[model samples]
Target: MRKKKVLLVLLLISQFIVLAQDYKFGKVSKEELKEKFYPLDSTADAAYLYKSRRTYYDYVQNMGFQLVTEIHERVKIYTKEGFDMATKAIVYYTPESGEDERVNSIKGYTFNLVGNKIQKEKLSQKSVFREQLNRFRTSKKITMPKIKEGSVIEIKYKLISPYIQSINDFHFQHHIPVKKLEAQVEIPEYFVFNKKTIGYYNVKLIKESKGGRIGDTQYGVNVFKFDEDNIPALKNDEPFVSNISNYRAGMKFELTQMNFISIGGDFKTFSSSWSNVSKQIYKSSSFGGELSKSGYYKDDLEKILTENTTETDKLLAVFQFIKGKVKWNEYYGIYSDKGVRKAYKDRVGNVADINLMLTSMLRSAGLNANPVLVSTRNNGVPVFPTIDGFNYVISMVELTNRGYVLLDATEPYSTPNILPKRTLNWNGRKITKEGNSSWVKLTSSKPAAEDNNLMVTISKDLLVTGLFRTKYFNLSGLTYRKNHNHLTEESVINSLEEKNNLEIEEFKLINENLIGKPVIRNVKFSSDNLVESINGKIYLEPMLFLTQHTNPFKLAGRKFPVDFTTPWKVKNMVSIKIPKGYKVEKLPESIAVGLPENLGVFKFKVKESGGKINTICVLQFNNAIIAPQYYNALKDFYGQIVKKQSEKIVLVKQ
Candidate 1:
C-alpha cells in the first residue's frame, strides 16, 4: 500500500510540473486564452505565463561592439483588473557620448477565445509611443489591442545599446506572479563584469563558451543563463521598506574591467573603486567643471561675503542667495542638466545645478564646502562602485563648532542642516574639487521631536471640549511646515477636523515662516463622539483622538530591514476635568514598555488627583533603522501601544 501511494504522488507531481508554459516568442496556446484564472495564484489579476530576456554582444562596424538585449513576454489576463498588463514599457539609457540606445522590431499580439475559436489582434503602430525620461534615459511604451478577461498578450522587442558599461538589469519577479522566467547574458571573453544578485529567490545558473568572429578577428563569448520557476510577485505594501526594487529578485551586470583584443589586449577599467568613480565624475564637464566657473558670480558673491565678516554669516548668506535665485525643477540628479552659470541665469534647474551653484558660492566665499553625491530613498543604496550609483547632490559645509552640516536648497521650507527625507538613504560620497573623496554618513544625529499638551472637559451629555497645543522641533518642524505650507488655512483645518472627527472652533499655526524655529499649532475643538453611554455608565478612551489606532507593521515575516530614516520622539500630556458629581470607576494601569537594546520606548501613565484625570504618554524611537529580526518585537510593541491607548475609563452614574 505504501509503494502504491508513493507511485501515485510521483505521477501527480509530474503532472503539476507540466503546467508552466514554454518561454518562446509568438507562442500563445488556446488553453491560455480560454483559462478563466491562474491556478497557481487565484488572487493574482494577471500572470506572466512565460518571460525571457537575452543580452548579448553584436559587433557593428560603425558602432563597434554594441550590446543587444531581446525580451519576450507572455501574460494571461484573468480579469478586468489585469487590463493594465496589456500595456508595456521598455526603458533604455543614453550616455554623454552622444550614442543612444534604440528599441526596434516591436511586435505584440493579443489572443482571445471567441465562440471556441482563437481570435487574434495585432498591435498597431498608433499604440506605440516614445518618451524621454531625462537627459540620460528614454522609454518606449506600447499598449496591446483587444485586451479583455481570459486574454493572452505576447510582446517581443529588441534593444540595441551603444554603451557596454550599462548592460541593464533583469527582474524575475514583478508586481504580477510569474510562472517561469529566464535571463541570459553573453559577454565576450575580453570583457569582465561582476554579476550582482539580490532578493530571496534562488536562481539556477548555467555557463557556456562559444566562438564568434568579427571581421578578421576571432573572439570567445561566455554565456551565463539564469532560470527561475514559480516566482511570486514582490509586493511593496510593507511599511518602512527602503525601496521595493532593492528587495525584488533581480540581477545586474556591472562592468568591472574590459580587455579587448582589438585594443592590444590591455585591461581597461570602467569603474574599479569609489575614488576612481569620484575622480571621473569630478573631471566631467557637467560636474566639477561647472564648479570652476565661479567667476560669473564672483562679484555678487564677493559683495555678500564682504558684508558678512564671520564664516557662519557668510555661509548662510551664500546659501540664502543661491536658494533664492535658483528654483529646482523637481529633478534629482548628481550632474548638472545645464551648466551652473546657465542654470543660475535661468533661475530654474535640476538638483545638481542648484547645489553645485551653492558649492561654488561657498567656495568663492572662502568657506570649506563640497558636493556630496547621494542616492535617494527610491533609488536604493549602491552596493558597488558605478557612475549611476548616486542620483542626488547636496552641499556640505565644515563648521568650526559642529564638525559638518549638510544642506539642500531644493525645498523652500528647508533650513540649513535639515535635508529633505527623500535624500536620507545612506552614506554619500563627498567629493572635492581637488580630486579627493570620502564616505560621509547621511544619518542625522539630532532627533525630530514633537510635544502635545491637551486640556479638555467631559460633560454629562458625552460631549468633550478641548484646547490643544502642539510643537514640532528639528526635522519634525521642517516636515510639518513643508507638508502644510502649500495648503490653505481653511483646507488644513478641515482636514484636521475630518481626521479627528471634531468640530474645530479656531486654529492657528505659529513660527511657520521662521527658519530654524519650532512650529506650533494651537487648536480648539469639540466632539460629541468622545464617549459612549451604556446603561447609565460612560466609557471613554483616555488617549482620545491622539491614539494610534493601527499598527503599521502587519506582515507575517519581513525579509528586508525597516528604514525609519530618522530618529524621533513624541510626548503627550493631557489633563481632563471630570463631570461634576461623577466618581472615578476604572482607570487604565500605568504601563512602560521598551524594545530590546533600548531602540525604542513607550510609556503611559494616568493619575487621578483633585477630582481630575491627568495622563502622560511618551514614545521614543532612538534608532532610524532596525533589522528584520526585530520586526515582530516592534510590531508587538506597537500592538501594546494600540491596546494601552484604547484602554477606557468607565464611570457609573453617581
Candidate 2:
C-alpha cells in the first residue's frame, strides 16, 4: 500500500505539471513577472508568453447566426525595441454592409516588479482610438499603459463579425518570438471549409469530431486545434523580397460550402472559379453593369472616335481622350464607386471607374477591350482563385495584328505598352464581357535605355569644364518625367548642382511635353575637384561624373532572386581633352566582360587619338530577373565595373 501510494502521488504530480504549463489570460505567474530575459532567445526584445484565439459561431436575435472570435495575448518585454508591441490594431468591416463588426470587453493590464513586489497598471479608456482605414475598413487602435523594460503586458478582446467568408487568419509566428500559441475553431456540420497552410515551416494540425450545442440544437461539430511552442520570430533579412507576407507561417479558412437543415440540407458551394467570379463581377451594379451603359459619354466619345481613322489610330485616340478626361483619385479597387456616368461628370474616380471608362471608349471605337485585374507588388501574389486576390484594374485592347496592348490611364505619362511599376507583380487575370477569362503575364517586353555624351577639357590647374547631354528612352523617360517633371527648372538645376557639387549653367530640357518622346537634358558644368594633384602627378577617374561609386549587390549571397522589373541598357560616350603640352602617362586597359549565361555584359574601351582621349562604356541586361545561383557572378560583375571606373587616369607634364 505504501509503494502504490508513492506511485499515485508521482502520477498526480506529472498531471499537475502539464496543466501548469498551459498559460491562461490574467493568470501570469510570479516567475513570468520576474523574468528578465527569455531563456531560449536572450537576444529577443520581447517574447509572447501566451497567445490564444478561439473562433466559433454565435446566434443573435436579428442576425440569426454570425461568426465570433475571441483573442487573448500576454507578452514580456525585455528591451526598448519591444515597446512597439504595445500598440494593438484590430481591423473590422466597413459600415456599408448594413451592420458593422462589433468589438467588446477589451481589457489590458501591465505588471512590473518593484522592490520585490508587483506593480499593476490598468489600461485607460482614452488610450483607445477608432479610425477609418479606408472606404471599406476601420481599425480599433490601443496603446498599452505603463509599458517598460521587463514588463509583462496582457490583453483580451472579443469580436463579433457578420462576414463568415472572411475568416480570420491565425499567425503562428510574428516579429517577436512566441513561447506558446494555441488556436482552435469549432465548425458546425452544416458548414464545410477548406483550410490552407502556407510558409516555409511545416505545422501539424489536429482535428476531432466533437459534440456541441447552439441555441437548443444539438449536433456534431469539427474542432480543429493548433498548438505550438518555441516559435522563433520571422524576419525578411533577405534581399529582393517584395512581399514578406508570402513567406509567413499562417493558416486561413476559406468557406467552400454550407448546408442548412431547414432548407432541405442541400450543400451550396461558395468557392468560385475564374469564369464564375468574372460572371458575377460583370453582373454586379458597379462593374460590368456600369460598363454596359456608356450613354453619358456618348457625345464626347462620338467626337473622339472617327470611322475614317485606322484601327491603331482610333485606339490611341480613344485612350488618350479618356486619359485626358478622367483623373485617378489614387485609390485601388475592382468596382466602380460613382458609376461611369457620374465619374464622367465629376472628372475624378477610383481605378475601376477610370479604367472601365477607358475600356468603354475603346469598344465604342470598334476595338475589343476588357478589364485586367491585377495584384500590385505590395499585394502578395495570388496563389488561389478567390475574389480577394486582385485589388487593381487596367484596360487591355486587341490590336489588328492579333497582339495585345495593356493600358493604365491612371498614370498620365504612361503609354500603350508601358505600365506603372506597381502593376508588375507576377500575372493578371483578363476578364471580358464575352466570358473569356485567362491569366496574362504582367512583365513588360520593352527595354529601358539611357544614352549620354560628355565632352570635357582639363586645364593645367586641374579645373575641368564639361558639357553633358542625356536622352532617356522608353520606360526610362516615362519614369523620369513622373519623378521630376513636377519640380521647377531652377529647382531641378539646384538639386543637380548640390548632388554633384559642381557649378551648373545653361540647363535645358527637351520634350518637356512628356508624351510619346524621349526626354533629353543638356547641362554645362565646371569642377575643380575632379582631379587630385599629388606627388607631381595628376590623378583622375576616366569616367568622371558618370562613374558608379558603389556596388548595390553588396551581399556575398542571397536567398531570393533580384528583380529589376525591366530589361535595361546604359551607353556612355566620353571625350576628354588632355591638358595642353601634357601627354597621358597611364590608362586603364580596355576589357570586355560578360555575366554567366550571357544575361548581362559590360564593355570598357579607351583610345587616344589626335591629342584627345575617348572612352566608351556600355552595360546591358538581357532580362530583368537574376536568380539566386547567379548572385555571385552578378556581384562580381558590378565589382569589376566599379574598379574599372575608379582607376586613375595619370597625366605627366612635359
Candidate 3:
C-alpha cells in the first residue's frame, strides 16, 4: 500500500514537470498566441499564461550564503488595453553588497503569428533603462520592441542578493488572471524561517526534503512549493481602500533564527518578536541614538516652554516650532537621514528625522513622549513583528489625563490627534526610552465633520440662484487644506462650478491658512439644470446638486473590510424658496435609517413652513472600518440614502 501511494505521488509530480516543460523560454505555442480571450476571466485585458519562480540560497567560500531567485513569465495580450503588459519593471534594493544584489541576466522575446509564421523580436539593451528610485532602491525597466493585440510575450530574469535573510514577497495573485503559477523556496536545514500567507485566497503547499553532504556533515534542503491554477484577477477598484496590495494573496518570509548545530557554527536570531524587533530597531544609531541628542533645538524649545506655562500650551508651541524648524524632504523612513541635528541646521529632513526630533523636544519639555513606528498608506499594514515592516515614524505625547495625542510634523495641515490620511493605517508601535514597545491605534477618537448649508431661490424663468456654504472640521478640515491649499483660486472655482453644475460669480474661502480652525467655503451660483418645468409644474430635487445619485459600494461581495480611515459625519441643510406664485404640490417624505451594531445612522427630514421649504440630512458613521460581514448592511444603508436624496418636490402654479 505504501509503495502504491509513493508511485501515485511520483506520477503527479512527473505530470506537473511535464506541463512546466511546455512553457520553456523561446517555446511559445501557436495555440497560446492565437487565443483571443482568457477562459477564467473574460473581462481580463491580458492573462498570465504561465508564471514560475525558483528561489534558493547559495553559499560562498568566505562571504557566506546568498539568496538567488530565478523568474519566468508568459503573458497573452487580448486587447489594446493590455499594451501596458509589454513593459516590465523590476525593483531591487541596493545595500552594502552593491551590484551583486540586483536583477541580472534579463532576456525577453515578443512573438506574433503572421500567415502561419512566428516573427520574433529580441529585447535590445536600448529598450532597457535603469532608474534610481531612492538611496537604497532602483528599478530596471524593459520595453519590448514590438507588441500588439493577440500577441504572446515571454521574459526571464534572475535576482542575486548577498542578503539571504531578506526575501522578497512572492505574489500568488495579480491584477490579471493567471492560468498557472508555481513558486518554490529551498532553504538549508541550519536556517529557520517563519512563513505567513496573506489575503483571502488560499493556496496549496507541498513540502519535501533532499539530503546532501558538506564536509562530512549531512544536511537537508527543505523545499516549500506553492501551486495554483486559474486565479482570477484581484479587482482593486473598490471604494475607500487604504491599500489593496496589503490584501493580496502572497507569501512573506521572515528569518527567525540561524541554528548552526549541525554545522558547528554560532546560532543567531534576526527578528523574533515584537520586543526583540523593537530593541533591535532602537539600537540603531539613526533612531534611539538620534533621540538622545537635543542641543540643536534645545534653546528654541526652552524659550517656547517658558513663555507657555501650561503643558497643552507647551505641546502646541513645540509642535508648531518643529513644523517651522524643519521641512520634509518627501522621503519615508524610520531611520534618520543625516541625523536630526544636521536636518535642524539645514531645515530639511525625512519623516523620521522630523518626528524623532519632535519627540525629543517634547521630552526635553518634561512631557512623556515617544516615537511611534508607522507604515504609510502605500506601505502595506504590518501584521507581524518584523523590523522591515514599518517605513514611517511620528511623535506621541501623553497628557496628564492619560490620553495620548499623535503628531506628525511632516504634514503642514496636520493638527494634534488628526493625522494625514497616509499615516492613518491600521496601528503603530510606540517605543519608549527603554526600547519597549506596544501597539497603539493611529486613528483619532474624534469624528471628521462636514456641514453644508444651502439657500436656494427659484425664478419664473426656471433658473435657480443659490448661496452654498460649507464648513469642514477636524480631520475633514485637514483633508481640505491638504488638497486645496496649493491649488489656484481660478482652478478651485472651476472645479466647484463643474462639480455643482453651476456658474459661480462669487467664491469665498476662509481659514485656509489657519490650523485647527474649520475651513469654510461659500459660493454664489446660478444653474438652469436644478429645476425641471413641465405643464406649468416645477420639479426640484430638494438636495439640489448634493443628491446621492450613486452608491460607492457596488461590489456584489467584498473580501476585505472597507477602510474609511476615520469616523466621519456629514450634515446637509437646504432651504428652498419656491417661486412667488407657485404652491407646494408634493414633498419627499421624511425618513431615518440606521446600520446594524450601531455602526452608522442617517436622519433626514423635510418641512414646509411659511414661505420656505427646508430639508435636513445627517449621516454619521461611528466606525471607520466596516467588516466584510457588514458589507450588505452598509450597501443597503447607502441605498436608502440614495433613494431618500433622489426624491423630488413638486411646485404647482397657484
Candidate 4:
C-alpha cells in the first residue's frame, strides 16, 4: 500500500509537467486580472497587450534573445586576370530578450587554376535562443515539412553592371530564391506601396506567446510579409509560426515604418574573390586592367582647339562634341567593366560612366576639365562628404578668356553654359588632378539670355495681325530644352491648339541647335475674328504667348524653402499696322514694375508711329532661388506682369 501511494504521487507530478508544456486556451477572470490586465479597447471583446506595455516588454525581455549565424563561401578560379568585386551588407532585427547577442561565423573557400571556368558557393544558417529555466517558459519550435503537393521556389537576381555588360554571360548561377529578396526602395510621399517580390515567399512563423509580465503574447516570424503575395506556405524546409494574422491585426503600420526579418539562405559560387574573376568575356574592362589613359584636359584640348580656333569657337566645339557624342542611360553605379573606352565606342552609358568618359576624353583633348560629382534633386540633398551621397556627375571646363562652363553631354538640347537639372544638388564636389576633391558652387551668374522680337502687319480682311518671339538662355534655356525632347512638335502643337480652342495654320521650328545658344522657336498661326466686336469697335489681347507670366505660388503659408535656380529675361513685341479702314482709338496704359536688386522686372509700352501701333512687353527674373519670406513679394511681382500682359488695345472702325 505504501509503494502504490508513492507511485501515484509521482504519476500526478509527471502529468502536471506535461500539462504545463502543452498549449492552453483560457479566459482570465475579472478578479484575477483586475490590476494585472485590462481591456484592449472599448470595441474589443477580450483584453490584449497594450502598446506601451508591449514596447516595454519588447525592450526589456524580447530583446534579450541570442542569435547565431554562419556563412560559408567558396570561389573558383578562372584565369590569370581576375574580376574586381566587393560585398556590402547590413543586418537589423527586434530583440526578444533583454540582452541581444549575434555571432557571425563566415568563412571563404578558394579555388585552384585546374578548371577554365570558376564556380562559387555560399552556405548560411541562423539559430535563435531564449534564456529560460524550462521549455515551458519559451514558445514551442515549429518546423515545416517537405511539400507533398505542387510547390516550387523561384529565385531571381537583379544585377546591374557599371556599364553595358551581360550578367548572364558571367555564369553566375546560385540556389533559387536568394535571401533578403526585398530591395531597400525609396518611397516618395505621393506614391503608394504596390507589390512583393519572390524572395518574400519564404517567411515562417517562429513564436506565439500571450501578453504577460513581458507583454502580450508576441508572435515572431522567420520572414517579413511585404505585399499581398508574401503569404507563406506550410510545407517548406524552414520553421515558422502561424499567428501572423493576429500580430498584424494588433499593430498599426505604414509603408515607411515597414521592415523585414533576417533569415539565412544558401548560395554557391566558384570564384572566391571578385579580383580573381575573368574579363575575357566582357566587352570592356577598365580599372581592373592596365591601360594608358589621359585625363579630361587632353581630350578637351584636342577636340576644342586647333591652329586657327578662337576662344568662342573652341568653347562651341567642345560643347557640341559633348552633346552630340554621348547618350544618357540614367543609371548610377561605380563598378562597370564597360569603362570610358567602351562607353565612347557605344556612345551610350549611365550618368557616371558617360560623364566619366566625357571627363577622360576632355583630358585627352588637352582642355582644362574636371569631374563634378553632384546629387540629383530627386535623389535628395547630400548632407556630408560620404562617397555614396553622389549619384550623378558633370564636367566643368575653364575657358582661356571666359569663366567656367558647366557641360552635360546627356542633354542634347543643353548649351555648353547650361548645367543639367541633376547638377542642382545642394552643391557639387570637384575632383581634381591631385586626387583631391572640393565643393563647387553651382549658382548661376548674371548676363544670361534676354531676347525680344515683334512683327506687326495689316491683313487684307481689315483685321490687325501681330507676331511675337521670345527666347531664353542659360538656366532658363536648359529648362525648356529638357522638356523639349520628351514630346514632338506635332504633339505640343496639338495639345496647345486643343487647349486654346484655336486652329493652327502655320507652325515651324526655326532652330534646333543646342550647343552654345538658346533654342529659337517660331510659331505662326491665325484665328478667325479673335477680337471682340462691340458698337463698331474691336478689342484684342496684347499677350498671345501661351506660357504667359503667372504666379507659381499661391499658398497662404509654407514651411519648406522655395528653390528656383534659373534666371530669365523675356521680351514680347506686338506690331499692329492699322487696317485700311480702321484706326487706333486707345492704347493700353504703359506700365513698369521692378523688384529689389533686379530680382524681377516687367515693362509694357505702346507707341503710334505712321498709323502703326507698336507694343512691347518684357519680364525678367534675375534670381534663381527665392526665400519663403519673399514669397508674397515674388507672387505680387508675377501678378503684375500677368495683368500688364493681359491688357487689351481698343480700335475703332472707320
- Using lDDT, give the best candidate's number: 3
Q: Model-by-model lDDT, in order?
A: 0.86, 0.83, 0.89, 0.45
**Which digits, one per residue and each the tens of the lDDT, describe model 3 over residues 1-654?**
999999987885455334434887889877777778875567899998899999998777677778999999999999999999999889888743355477889999999998898889898889989987656678899998789999999899999998777888888888898888989999899888889999888888899988755656678899999988877788787788888888888899888889886676888888778888888888888899999999988779878977987779889999999999899999899988778999999999999999999999999998999999998889997667788899999999989986899999999999999999989888999989887899999989989999999998998898899899999999999999989999999999999888888999899999999998999999999999999988889998889998989999898889899988899999999999978999999999999899989999999999999899999999999999999999999998999999999998999988
Model 3, CA-based lDDT: 0.89
Clashing pairs in 3: none
**Candidate 3 deviant stretches above 4 angstroms:** 1-21, 96-100
* Candidate 1: count of backbone clashes, pairs at least 3 residues apart or interchain: 0
Expressed as tens digits, the lDDT of each residue in 75-147 for candidate 4 is: 1111112111112131222134332222232222121212333222221122122233221123211111121
lDDT of 1 by residue, 8-113 (tens): 8788546544764555666676767766776657788999888889999988886578889988888999989889998888888776568788899899899888
* Candidate 4 global TM-score: 0.53
Clashes of 3: 0
* Best candidate (score: TM-score): 1
Q: Distance (Å) between predicted and true CA of 387, model 2?
A: 0.6
RMSD score of candidate 4 (Å): 21.3
Model 4, C-alpha of 89: deviation from truth (Å)? 19
lDDT score, candidate 1, position 470: 98
Candidate order (TM-score): 1, 3, 2, 4
User: In candidate 1, which residue ranges exceed 4 Å CA deviation?
Assistant: 1-17, 20-22, 95-97, 261-265
